[model samples]
Target: MPTATPSPDFVAALREYQPLVRRVCRLYCQDADDRQDLFQEIVLQLWRAWPRYVPQPDAKLSTWLYRIALNVAISNLRQRTRRPARVGLDDDAARSLAQPTESSAYEPEEMAALYAAINRLSDVDKAFVLLYLEDRPYDEMADILGITQNNVRVKMHRVQERLRRLLVPASTH
Candidate 1:
């Protein structure tokens, strides 16, 4: 059977949402090459699923995007072989974690450590962290994760506690 081409509307939507897709890629992937591969795979899956997409008045586009992106990332993570754990930072790592000029939140080292801790989380926990960092509503997070809102709330709290343990100083603990 011949394959269906993606519609123009789908193409336009993907273009507009590409940054969101890339952000998902960044959250899940460590290396630049891996990030690119994940990005391409996500776009492929999104294109394949585009025909089935039905716009609902109550649903936001980002909800669908998050669902697809997280599912693909988790699946990809499962399929990959494990690599040696990395320790210490390099120039590339520092560059990637660089903060915007307008922001004076966490220092670069703190940001890198936070990201490293996030990377250590299970795929499901990482999804919770990603949605929380994005400031997604519990309802939308539950919908994207296909869990009850209360479950999302519970999981999110646990994930926050885990991150605190990972990022906080021992003296503060």
Candidate 2:
């Protein structure tokens, strides 16, 4: 019997894919500790599935990795039980987790408000927001989410409207 060595390309692929999981986890998890844990979980899942990754000529490797990472992050059942203490803006601990932006206009409060609104959204809607914020095209977003582009547009519009309504004070309602 002949033994085959693991390819170096697999190691490189894992390294390249790590950031996608990290970013998605950061968006989904509000606290540093929870985000780190989620990242670890996602990586573990990815590593487990890596050997079975057969490449298709038509599809990009990054997209395939992204789908797996997003699926793992979005459908993670463990998150329900181990909810992060610093969810959205209310928790004082959330401040430290904010990513720095080059522009001065970036405000943690606004991000907190957005996240607070997002928390009220359904899981599917949260995926829409995450993809939208990542600047993905409607076609790609639709493909990743398993919906038509038109439906994605319509749902995205509704999601934004709902988020806006959530941000408004009760007095305005």
Candidate 3:
């Protein structure tokens, strides 16, 4: 079957939102190859769904993009089987991992530990974390997650507590 081409508006929107999509992929995918695959799958799904999207005056485009990306990532993660552990990072990846971002408040090691903790979270919890980290308003997050604002608030507080427990060493408790 011939594939439908993405509309010009869709293409433009995708290009504009690519970074947000990539961030979602990174949060869900540990491996570079897996991230790439997830990114492609998200783009494909976005293109397929674009025709159905109706822009509401009060709705933000980022919220819509995030909802679709998170859904795709969560679905993809569930469908994937475990692969053999990666032996080592490539030179570039190693360097990147070792180097902390200049603007980041945390050291490289601290950031790595934080990411490791995040990776341990359940998919739904991870979605909560991602939305919170993005500084999304409660209303937008509730809409994206298809929950009430009160639920979003309750879940977010729980997620924060869980993350704190994960990050704190038992020896220190």
Compared with the true structure, all predictions reach lDDT values of: 0.85, 0.73, 0.85
In terms of TM-score, how similar is model 2 to the real structure?
0.79
lDDT of 3 at 7: 78
Model 2 over residues 11-89: C-alpha lDDT tens digits?
6887776767777886676666767887877767666676787888766677667687778877773465476454345
lDDT of 1 by residue, 11-49 (tens): 899999998898788888777788899999999998888
Could you give me the TM-score of model 3 versus the true structure? 0.88
Cα displacement (Å) at residue 82, model 2 = 8.4
C-alpha RMSD in Å of predicted model 2 compared with the true structure:
3.6
Error of 3 at 154 (Å): 0.6
At residue 25, what lDDT does model 1 achieve?
A: 88
TM-score of each: 0.87, 0.79, 0.88
Residue pairs clashing in model 1 are none
Task: For candidate 1, give the lDDT.
Answer: 0.85
